[model samples]
Target: MVVGGDAAKEYVAGFAAGVATVIVGHPFDTIKVKLQTHNTKTQVKEYKNAIHCTSQILRSEGVKGLYRGASSSFIGMAFESSLIFGIYSQAKQLLQGETESIKPQLQVIIPSAAFGGALISFILCPAELVKCRMQVQGRDSANSNYVRYAGPLDCALNTMKSEGVKGIFRGGFTTLLRESIGNATFFSTYEMSRHYMHLQLNSNSSARSQQSKILSDVGIGIISGGLAGMAFWTAVLPLDVAKTLIQTAPDPNSSRDPFRTLGSIYSRVGLKGCYAGLGPTLARAFPANAVAIVTWEGAAKLLGVKRD
Candidate 1:
């Protein structure tokens, strides 16, 4: 049975971290999404580089523009992070059981994390849809077919009204693929990185055991979380590009095959199209996710979560 307080702490920690994530990293996310959806057409294109995009947003819409979708992102990610973390911890507990001998080894962790990733995709779909649609608006050309959403609630209502609830899951396949692979590696990286960090920083075994019990250092969490983000993005960015494309499509009803679009983009722009916003994404991933993971772990600890 799941312990009540433990899950509550996990949820709260994840929520706090999710808020920090949006505050710290939303601008980079905005730029990354913008770049990912940039048009290479001859007539009307806005941003040329990450720096240029930052400049454009600052100039045109001021600082507030950089946080265009902050509301949707903040709220959605709060739930998204909370669910991912709380569920993952509970799932991990279930998988580990009372077998202290198992040691949360790679065999156990990889699959458990994958399970959490898959389940979290349910919440991520709508969150991502609203965030992507909001981010891509006003940036499109005057003749573009994109729709402007007033906010997250309006976005959800309109989407459901026109296309039904299924429309909320527009790019769900890609989200699942990305999150499953990404989180599998994320947990693995965190476990291994912590062990390695203890080795490098703690010369004495007793000292290491006491000091590095669990998320003892914010820096370690940041480093490992950043490493995990790098691993996740490097492995799944092409799929992410495709996911964003589908999620941010203009006509909600005008459906084109996702697999075909992935193929078409790959064939047209080679690997470049698939990796359009990689730089900014990587930059954001490290700091953003680092803060998130650290906050989640730290908050759980403060709220009385026991060390494994």
Candidate 2:
């Protein structure tokens, strides 16, 4: 039935795209999470950089270590991406109205994207909390000193049992902030870039060159998507660091108020702590997001998503 109509097709497209995207980018995500939550006060930091981190994981935990917490990511992305892309398309359309403008206005896109981000943050919070905690486990002497969850499901279940439902929403405020700001920048950048590219590439082309135009659009999508991805990460990296710390904190009994988590990060490591994993996060942004946005766009096109 989902394949029987446009709305269904959109859902299916987003679901499939999310699955493919997590596969392509999960290792990079793992590294980024580990880096973000790394405590500098430890006897020694777990890794010096992305390279050393990858090397250590491979040498110590094997390839599986690189994929730690991926199951949670898959579950998170499946729901988060579907909700975000689906809601964003609907919201953008409402903003665009029945006028059928030739192109989307920035005013229409910015708020729509922000709303979508805000909506998905609630869904993303719990899954992301489990994912980050699982990813960073075993690295710490405390976790090494005790038992860890069997997997993401176990982590979520245990968290719920011990701390109730609200425990899963750790860092929810920061997640909301990060998603809203990042996604606003992300969608706006992508739209503006793609529009400019269209103007440049299609200005002189004719009907006979349609294929070339399509190819050009694909190329433009990659670049624009990369730019959008980078903008999102760079704008929200500090908040993201705080979110990771709150989500991965060993003590669920401890408060995870956004201001408190932020203050803790600053107090312990100063400004640099908030940007701890910036290098790896930026490195992951380009290729991973380029691929995700392209795949999402390509899938949406096939499913007739025009506004987003």
Per TM-score, the best of the predicted structures is: 2
lDDT of 1 by residue, 1-308 (tens): 23545778888998988888898889998898888787421224467788898898888778988898788888878888888777777877778776664233787678878888898888888888888888887554477667777777888788888879889889888889888888888888887886678567766444545445554577788898888877878888887888888888776754435566678677766767778788898999899889988887788778887665
lDDT of 1: 0.79
Candidate 2 ranges beyond 4 A from true positions = 1-5, 40-44, 139-147, 207-210, 304-308
- Candidate 2 lDDT over residue span 201-279, tens digit each: 7676646476776677678878998898899999988888888877877777666676776677778777777777787
lDDT scores in order: 0.79, 0.79
* Clash pairs for candidate 1: none
- What is candidate 2's local distance difference test score? 0.79
Candidate 1 Cα errors over 4 Å, as ranges = 1-5, 39-46, 101-104, 139-141, 204-216, 254-257
